[model samples]
Target: MTRPHDAAILELKNLLGPKGWSMERDVLETHNREARGKFEGHADIILFPASTDEVAKAVAICAAHAIAIVPQGGNTGRCGGAVAGQDQVLLNLKRMNRITEIDARDFTATVEAGAILKTIQDAAEEHDLLFPLSLGAEGSCQIGGNLATNAGGLNVIRYGNARDLVLGLEVVLPDGSIWNGLSKLRKDNSGYDLRDLFIGAEGTLGIITKATLKLFPHPKHIATAWVAVPSPEAALDLLALARRTTGDAIAAFELMCGFAHDMSVTHLPNLTRPLASQTDWHVLIELTSSRPTDDLQSLLTDLLGDAMEGELARDATLAQSDAQRKNLWAIREGIPEAQGFEGGSIKHDVSVPVSKVPDLLTRGMAAARDLIPGIRPCPFGHVGDGNIHFNFTQPLDMDKADYLAHWENLNRVIHDIVAGLGGSISAEHGIGQLKRDELAHYASAEKLKLLRAVKAAIDPDNRLNPGKVV
Candidate 1:
């Protein structure tokens, strides 16, 4: 027996031609599952639209049939946002992977939604420019997903979030109409700024088809260091000192807990610790400059002298070679992947004021201990920007399933502290199914009302990526 959505899926396949979609069970299964190991969604048919025109046509047919669509990019999202339901059409935009234009003069690049982030970054590097949206999933995550989720990475302290990098966007709305606002101009005081609506909306209001991104001059001289800090409080002081000493040259300032580092090193025995001193806290710092004459190495050395003398840092290791620098970064980036190999981890991608991060960590860890006595805290992330991945690895003797059962309770405990500190429940990762209820629970009545109003105004039928961020 044919289902109602089956007709819409059939129409979509017909609209895009046989080569544009996949009905094979394996392909459908792969796209339906999320990266978090949580079985979230199911889609019978997947659509592969090659261009904005094809996307518009497919969307129009779906709209005619009142069928829902879940637009997927690289499917590398931490949240379950990209997964589509069994009754919905999965629109994978990988075929739209094109760096349509690179304007060296304007310092902008126009790219299709499916373009891989690393591909764009490399293309920008070839032109002696930098994209600066560095993240672990850059190699696999697509530009559209980054934009849709407003992805924040290592360079956010200097470059800013994914939304900050976008100059303009071209989006396909719920009614199957195209909004081509892809302006390359840096300044456009035009009405209601529609580009932002789709960039971080998780494709609920519209599907991002293309984007024009801002670029910066490539850094020439680089300085990297791994320092042991007394505590999170001292780490903040070190960050302040680095910013004051180096000004705008600070590219990345990260805070890592010792357990996270040990997990990574233990998971991959070949990877060594960046620092010899075994402090509970570590800060990975990097400074970069476009000019070769900047002498960031000397600047960093002098800063480390003051940090150590002033007691902000206990000990430090500076990267003397490019290979050493990459190795340092490899350790930092490998933490999340390493956690996967350990056991069940209750993850929280959250943020507070930079000033309150120390308090958040102190109180949050204490609270987790009170709730689950033997739980291990693997907290780490951008101390410069206030976002911390306050993750908890299960107790050594606990069963994986039993530990995971505390996911919701732990979220409540941590989110309660976050709410007390006036912090966000979901920072970089959007409110996919995992946190949809949490959003409603934490958001102010006025804010929730406004959000629903906007959704109703743009997507009245609840067709575009339904049940996502409203």
Candidate 2:
């Protein structure tokens, strides 16, 4: 039987040509599945546009028929934001990969949405500049997806989120009109700040086509160290002391629970403990200086010494060489990937105030243990910025599906604690289909009204990323 949207699909295919559009089962299946494999949905068709003009034209066709469009970048998103539901069209931006310009003097790079994050970082390095948004999926995640989600990564402590790093964006609005707001100027102070609207909107407001990103002076000296802290409280204290002593030169401050560290060593090969003695919590610190004359190594060493003397850190290990530095970071980055091997992990990307981290972790762990005996809690992430990946691994010898059945129940138990502490349910990850209902439960009526107003004003037809965010 022919579907109702088949006619429109045929028209779209012809408009985009064979190379740009496809209804093949493999293509549909590939685009439908999300990164975490937790959510999946089907699409009516997939459209790949190579330029801003092509994207605008394709969007016009979809808008004419009132067909829902799901804009996708590298599909590296943890949330189901990139997945399209039945009768919706999946708009892929990989073909639009282009680094149009790199202004070394201005310290900015203008690139298409499909450009890979690592590629952009490498380009900046060639010009002796740094694109400081470093994430685990940098090699494959596209810049557009990063901006769409307002990604916060390791360097957020130093450079802020993706929204802070982007100077301008060129977006295709819901009605097929192009909004060319791409400017490299440091300060605009213009109208409603449309660039910020589309960013972190997850394509609900519009499609991000290209961006002008901010760059920093390349760090000539870098020092990485792993320290064992007695508790999360001590870790926070050490963070403060490090900032005060180093003059805010710390690039990344990560906190990992002992359980998370153990998981990494157990599942990931070639990963070893950084410190001699294992403590309840571990912190990985990195300091970078753009000036070649600065001795970041000695500075980090002095900070660690003071932390140990003050009892903020139980033990510490400074990377003596580049190889050691990479090894230390690998352990930090590998924790999420290594978690899969532990089975049925219920994950929560949450954030609380910097001071309340200890209370959150201590109380949260206690609650989970009480709820499910033998459940392994693996809470870890950017403690400096107050975000923590509060993940839980199922009890050993239990069925994976059976343990996953309690996902919703566990979410309630943990998210309630987060709410009580005035924290957010979703932190770095935006509200996609996965957290859509949760957002409704947590957001206030006024907040929901504002979101609805924005969605209505920009996409009254509800043809863009339907059933997401608002």
Candidate 3:
């Protein structure tokens, strides 16, 4: 039996006053769609819980009445995990923003779900510590959302993803039970490891309210450089060279194709070219060390000199200042926006083994162009970690809608190549409405069954973010 909408709205309004809830259409429109403007859904009511108890109470009320609840944070997710269907109640974590604790001795920081990524990073920086999981959306994206999607970004090559950085989680379960598992211990041998389950569940199982995250000692010496390479193979080779020279000090190694760099300069403002020679490939390498006395620049200089002699690097430019370093990064960071201006683009956040990146790009590019004549493949991303954001801008003189019409076709071509290389189709982006079918098609039957079983066990009613990442 369908519950009456009036009764539901009245009950929610009484339970959470004007400070805690909003049923206004204009205000709720922002929460209807996703960050990419891809999928949109309606939630007549949105609850802004300021604390865990409120979130739990709101969930309990909704759970008893069999109303779906969607957990949202910052609404900066690339995937549509935060969106909800009609009549559902949206639980926005933004009001819960708070930095509860920062234990420098324990190397842990506890923050509420609504705390923005940049705010946490700033707090950590104040204490000469670092929380390295960072990305383009750090300024607006929240930590809970990052954990839900298990986001991977620039520092992933050195610091790992959101899952790795989290030490413990405080979540409001589907049944409205507040699970206080916020442990700050560096090592815990307790059984079940339930904290890991909710890390990347996309809020289907539970809503993360607070998190205790691991922090690292701030790096003393930092080095940044941009290198020009002849091919993807050469970029990979240069990555190996830098790894051998600097070892674990290498923080990020992003590869950008010449076309990608050119697009950035032409489409985006203030994005001047970084290298002297325009090679087919460009590598943005950064090195960081905790040792204050370390000479990162000299080390990088020697490594690049060797790479040049060995033909691994065609040319390179080292950033002499912080501003220069940012300019070098701007070229790679502006790929998404730059590509947006070029025309309609089909994006694939896929990953293959570093050893197979060259083959993957070469084969994938050839296959895509063959499928859509004159198609331009702009494959670039975290080359050191083997995760490439392979996107295709439409042909120079093609219709935007015509290019967009081939999204599925382009995805098939690229994902097929990724699968053939033993790679993942969705690397950092969660399996939201965008890639639900693709995930279902590619994931093994056993894996799918196991995932579904877990979801059923945790959220049998499917009240939390229905029709998403199941």
lDDT (tens digit, per residue) of candidate 2 on 247-322:
9999999999998888788889887778778778999999999998999989999999999899999899999999
Q: Which residue pairs in candidate 1 collide?
A: none
Q: In candidate 2, where is summed lDDT lowest over 10 consecutive residues?
A: 1-10
Q: 1-470 in candidate 1: lDDT tens per residue? A: 12336667777777899889998988987888798767566777888999999999988888888778899999888878888876788899999999999899999999999999999999999999999998999999999999999999999899889999999899999888999988998888878888888878999999999999999899999999999999999999999999998876899999999998887877875677777678899999999999967999999999999999999999999999988898889888999989988889999999999999999999999999999989999999998999999999999999999999999999999999999999998889888777889999999999999999999999999988888875
Q: What is the C-alpha RMSD of each candidate to the true structure, in Å?
A: 1.4, 1.5, 1.2
- Where does candidate 3 have its weakest 10-residue lDDT segment? 1-10
* Winner by lDDT between candidate 3 and candidate 1: 1
Report the C-alpha displacement of residue 135, candidate 1, in angstroms: 0.9
Give me candidate 3's TM-score against the actual structure. 0.98
TM, every model: 0.98, 0.98, 0.98
